[model samples]
Target: MILANVTLSGCTGANSALCAGAGEGHLGGGSYRTSLTPTGNLIVAVCLGFIGTFGLTNNLLVLMLFCRYKMLRSPINLLLINISISDLLVCVLGTPFSFAASTQGRWLIGERGCMWYGFANSLFGIVSLISLAVLSYERYSTMMAPTEADSSNYYKVYLGIALSWVYSLVWTLPPLFGWSHYGPEGPGTTCSVDWTTRTANNISYIICLFVFCLVVPFLVIVFCYGKLLCAIRQVREINASVSRKREQHVLLMVMVMVICYLFCWLPYGIMALLATFGPPELVTPEASIIPSVLAKTSTVINPVIYVFMNKQFYSCFHALMCCETPRRGSSLKSSSKAIRAVTGPRRSNDFLFMVASLGQPAATVPQLGPSFEPTIDITKGPSSDINNPVVVSLVAHYDG
Candidate 1:
């Protein structure tokens, strides 16, 4: 949680009077030495405004798309729809208040308001993290263990989604229960975990939060994506061209999770840990606020990645928004047609691949023609009708 007021005061002779008592603001006697100028406040406002607006709009569109299209209902995409809900919560519950405060240059919401804001922020943020970890694991299992990936077991993800909310709520609610506390973090305009407090309870909560929420989730995401990549490589080793799309998709998944966690949450985690255990001066208000700002970027970045990277979602998005299918010559249309052809009318194979691909038939493959079999013998080489069938490139598409 972060909060601020009068940060728009520039160091001019006129503003000097306005800023005089501002620099002397206190959180437990530690002075607010952050040079929160009008420029900084404006920057914060603009960034928050853009992220808040665009993130909310896009995520809502995502949710609506999922709801509007019956075909979009799948276990994997259900995870994304859940994520859209979480992001929407963040936008509605957290962004407006922060944006108002940042623009107005003050924390108008009282102590109670601060707690609510912090609670919402932590709740939604943590849910997003856990949801993503679950998604990665789900994708991994669907790809590598096709047997258990059927719709019969897809109900498991919904149960996991409910538990994810509880998991986030469990950790975040301790503050309300007197195990820890919440308050304005940096500027006194936003609210969050009381990192400045050095106490047995607060420290314990912080450590446990870091371990369970950040560290554990981070490790899980890395492991799941890494394993998925290795699985695709195994496919490649058997049939080179058949695995390119799979490898790239898995690689991109790994990069998104790994990079987002490291950049968005790692700094905040480090600074929070330092606040508890390192030299007090090292975790300055200004320094700490940097990471906090970075973390908020994840809300905007996540949905964009999903829409741009996944062919299936983008198609649905395009169709929903534009009121028409992708143009016939468009790469997406070609990809869609190609994928449908590869898995064409082959219920058994498509069903198996559907589970493997997380219930989204989004992959594009080199058209293997009418002779294509639902059950190709992995033991046999390419047939004459499919002279270059072994050379046929396959894209492991994801519907999510």
Candidate 2:
């Protein structure tokens, strides 16, 4: 990803005559020299630095929020936790190398370093994609079947995470095994997969890898989230009391992350595809530069999008930052007060009215006793007269 412009001054051993007319001549009038100009290096550096700092800070905040807040430890949050971890990896490992490559316009790390860098980069990228895909599927299942999906299923999420890491390893291992080559680019070398060879075999392998690893996974993410949104709409229509606002917020965040992911990687995928099948001359430094910058950008943006956009995450983050422990007793007391307010004596009839309005077939008008007792048939359906004032008195007294 490094681009360097070199201007030779006074050639060394062979071409002394070329420097004769020049104002500043070399020792033998044949000295070899070069002038390196940084193109977009500062911009790349600033972007990498900003993204790295933000990603690390935000992701760590997310992790701490999940760890510190017991109430936030839901199955859905577990998926987010995985996403944060993957994002942190990208920020820590990928961004630094990107900054160096863009600024230096050369791969100072050498061949082995480049291989390891590529492996780590590919690994984290795969983890991010798979984690997002898994998150989408989790949302789909939760929206489609909430009662069927409980806290116990979170262990399956853990298993899926383990599987994702395994899958990522499968993709990253090939380069190290010599099945593929990854190293610094030409004369003014930079670290990247050595795709500039323009060989049919190399091109085909890259095209296949891009399609399977990046493109297909993105499509899966979109499809899964689309279904989840539809299911959410259906659920909200059926049960307006369910309050899907928080889930919708989460879905929007995931969608944004997915869209950003695609935008960042799409260029890289396209470049790789083009590099494989096209002429070598077409693989210009300028052509690859933007894609490199964009791909690096994706690594750093994930944490920011997740935290700032999510309210529950923000609240938990604030609680953690303030070093405030959750007060369970106070929360329980508040819950009790809320329940009483909803189901209290004066509201008994209101509750019954709501239940009856739900169109349950077994509703009936109950016979009131002299004591004004509200008899609720838990087995059958709500009683029509359950909303009577006397019944309300009975319900309040019974609850008290």
Candidate 3:
């Protein structure tokens, strides 16, 4: 709880006034010194403000979408809501304080405030990471067992959600109990795990945190998605009904999510490790700021990639805002019936549910006119499942 008012070594000129005793770069209670100028502080403030505003807005909209649409309440999607809540909490409890401190060019809140900021952000962020891992595994398991009646049972989903939070708590609580510490981080405007403290107490915690929190979750995501892709490829070979374009779309979505997760978090993780294990001066205060900013940017990028890109959600969102009722179609029911008729009751259910998981049936799934009758397309050739009405319909539904 020691507050340092150490002066910067190279500060001069008008910037010197801002750097004057206890004026700037002075974390209220920490050993670290910030080398940021007033201009740097202003830039940090602007970034935090932008992230806070958009993150709050987007996450709230996602919450609203979940509440307004019954279809969105599927067991798997509940995990998405869990992620949004954590991101929203970061926007609410973490971002604003950092924004205010950045504007003032120092940590405004006292030692207790710094502790809370560090602990809360760590808790919420880890929860999001664990939840994403669980989400990927859930998607994989659900797809693999699509034939199971309770493949996506709420009990299992809720158990996963609870475990994610509990696991995050196990990692985050140690700092408070003195396994490590939370103190002013980059430029003295934010706070996090005491990366600069090279003591065994701090170093042990950082190593464990990196392994359990970052590396494990990332590996889980990669493995589950890899298997999911392989399974989809297998299904495509066995059933020509599956759309290649839709498979590509699913692959793109998976890649975007994984890439975004890595892009946002990897630098911050590497920086922390460097600060912990490398030479004392290896990571500059100015250099540390970028990774912190990138980590927070995840709060903004998540909703766009995870929820907004979903076609069913996109159409419903448009309908909700534009005051146009979403188009009605019995295609989903008929499609299911046709699939059941062809594959029989037991096997067809899995295919239908797999399609739903791949992507929900959009409003654009074609409706059959009363005069129309199901017919095999001879021109589609022997290899094409286009001859099967069920397969033809499935492709159209997926193309949405």
Query: lDDT per prediction?
Result: 0.64, 0.54, 0.69
Which candidate leads in lDDT?
Answer: 3
Judged by lDDT relative to the true structure, which candidate is superior, 1 or 2? 1
Task: Give the local distance difference test score of model 3.
Answer: 0.69
Which candidate model has the greater TM-score, 1 or 2?
A: 1
lDDT of 3 by residue, 1-400 (tens): 1112235674465224434533432443532234478888888889999999999999999999778876566676688889899999999999998888888766667667888999999999999999989988776665444232242358988999999999999999999998988877756778888887667887888899999999999999999878766655544655545446445756897899889999999999999988878876577777888999899998899888867775445655777899865433311111111221112223222222222112223332345554333231111111112222222312211221
Q: Report RMSD (Å) for each prediction in the order shown.
A: 9.5, 12.2, 9.0
The top-ranked prediction according to TM-score is 3
Ranking by TM-score: 3, 1, 2
Question: Residue pairs in steric clash, candidate 3?
Answer: none
Lowest lDDT 10-mer window, candidate 1? 332-341
Q: Put the candidates in lDDT order, highest first.
A: 3, 1, 2
Q: Residue by residue across 1-400, what tens digits does model 1's lDDT show?
A: 2222334344344334323434454332332332356777788788888889988888888887667766556667778877778988998999888788777766556657777888899999999999988887776655443122444355778887997899999999999889778776665445688875677988889889999999998888888767656655655665565556656755776687588778889888887888778764556544565677778877887787654455556666677678985432222121111211122223433322321222112333335455433332121111112221222223233233
On the 0 to 100 scale, the lDDT of residue 327 in model 1 is 35
2 versus 3: better lDDT goes to: 3
